[model samples]
Target: MKLYIKYMVSLRCKLLVRQELEKLGLHHISIELGMVEIKEEITEEQKQGLKSNLAASGLELLDDKKSILVDKIKSVIIEMIHYAEEIPKGNYSDYISEKLGYNYIYLSNLFSEVKGITIQHFIIKHKIEKAKELILYDELNLTEISYRLHYSSVAHLSNQFKKITGHSPSFYKKLGKKRKDTLENL
Candidate 1:
């Protein structure tokens, strides 16, 4: 059976899930972002145990189809933003659509209804968060950061950064590691 997981967006979460499965003596075929497939069918008691285990680790097993789809969407976006070395070419809408096998309009509508934000807004929020990370790392100048994030220009990046963060990237860097929101929060 394939289990859909909520908030399984990071490598640490994957490890935790794997550990939980092993603790339960379940043989998992694979565990990817937001999902786990196991070779054997799980009993109700085992499912409940697994769910509680995951809950203790700040994850949830999704049952509803709509909720599962939403989790999948979040997984894809998180992977693209936090893990990918570079943002993939082409528009995110197209990428998401192709990745999920849903039409762009349907994905946008579902995401907006479920997330209470447009998909574009979600992408922008993640991009700004990534920009902050790069700023804190101090390895890349603002210009390079802009280019790395696929912003058209440094000014555009600065404007968006200021708009979202109420401070320029330079000022934020100087402030020295102000708390950043977790990826799950974003």
Candidate 2:
């Protein structure tokens, strides 16, 4: 059975979730961001125990189809930003649809309904977050980062970053305060 989880974003979170399942004597076949597939269906008592334990850690087990779809979309974006070495420049709609094996319209509508935000907005938000990460690492200049993320130009990236974050990328880097969002929200 595939179980959707909230806030299972980082590698550390994946390990933590794995540890929690082991503690509860649950055998999981695989674990990934925002989800896990267990070897067997969970009993009601086991579900409740998991719900309580995960809630204490600020994670929730998701059950509904729409919510699960939303998590799947978020998971794809997170993986792309955090792990993918390169993303091609093109219509991301087709790319995401192909990657997730769902029609773009279905994914977009479901995501907006569950998240109260458009998928494009979510992507932009995460792009800004990735920009922050790159700038923090000081591995690339603003222009290089802009090209890496396939932004039209540095000006465009700066404009979008300022609109979402109320600060320019350069200013954000100067302040050096780490801004972040929860994985579910991001």
Candidate 3:
């Protein structure tokens, strides 16, 4: 049985889920961001127990089909921005559509309806968040950060960074580690 979880966006959440599964004697085949596959079918009582336990830990066990799709979209975007070695070089719309096996139009509409934010806005937010992390690390110059995040140019990156964050990247770097957001919150 496969289960979709909302707000399971970090390694910590994965560990918590695994622990809960073990407590219930559920053998899991795999646990990825926002999802888990168990080796055996789960009973209703087990599902309820797991759901309650997860809820107490600030995660949700998803059941609705639409909610599951939305969570999958979030998982893909999170993985792409935070975990991938490099952002793909093509249109993000094509990449997301291909990854999720849905038409871009449908996915965009569904994401907007469920998330109350356009998919583009979400992507920009995450990209800017990543830019902040790179800036704080102090290892990469603005130009390098721009290139690493696949921005068209430093000017383009600066423009979007200021637009989303209300400050230039340099200012953010000056402020340092005090302002970074966790990946789950983004």
Candidate 4:
């Protein structure tokens, strides 16, 4: 049996889900970002127990087809942006469509309807967040960060960073460093 989980985005979340499944005596054959395949079918009682346990931890066991598809879309985006070593080359729409085996237009429309934001906007938001993380790490300069996030140039990255965060990348880096320094002093 395959189960879809919502909000299971992080490694920590995977661990929690695994623990939950074990507690229910269910054997999971595989657990990916948003989907899990179990060795055997679960009884209603077991399903309820797992569902409530997951809910308490801020995750959800999804059943609705539309919701599942949306969660799958989100999982793909999160994996591509936050987990992948490098962003894929070429158009993001094509990448997403290819990954999900759906038409880009259909995915875009569904994503917008469910998420109240276009997939492009979502990707940009995640890319900027990744940029912030890289900046705070103090390893990559703006040019490197821009290239890592697939931005056309530092200028383009700077524009989007400022637009989304209301601060330039340099200023944000300085601010993050200062905050870290202050925390260390305390």
Best by TM-score: 4
Q: lDDT per residue, candidate 2, 1-186, as tens digits?
A: 989997778888888888889988999999999999999889998898888888888888988888888888898888877778986577778878988899999999889988899999998998899998999888899999999999999999999999999999999987764343333356
TM-score of each: 0.91, 0.90, 0.93, 0.98
Cand. 2 Cα-lDDT: 0.87
| Candidate 4 lDDT, 66-94, residue by residue in tens | 88998999999999999998999889999
Model 1 reaches what TM-score against the true structure?
0.91
Better candidate by lDDT, 2 or 4: 4
Please give, for residues 40-156, the per-residue lDDT of candidate 3 as tens digits.
Answer: 999999999999999999999999999999999999999999989999989999999999999999999999999999999999999999999888888999999999989989999
Candidate 2: minimum summed lDDT over ten consecutive residues — where? 177-186
Where does candidate 2 clash, by residue pair? none
Q: State each model's CA lDDT, in order.
A: 0.90, 0.87, 0.94, 0.95
The local lDDT score (0 to 100) that residue 76 gets in candidate 2 is 83
- What lDDT does candidate 2 reach at residue 70? 87
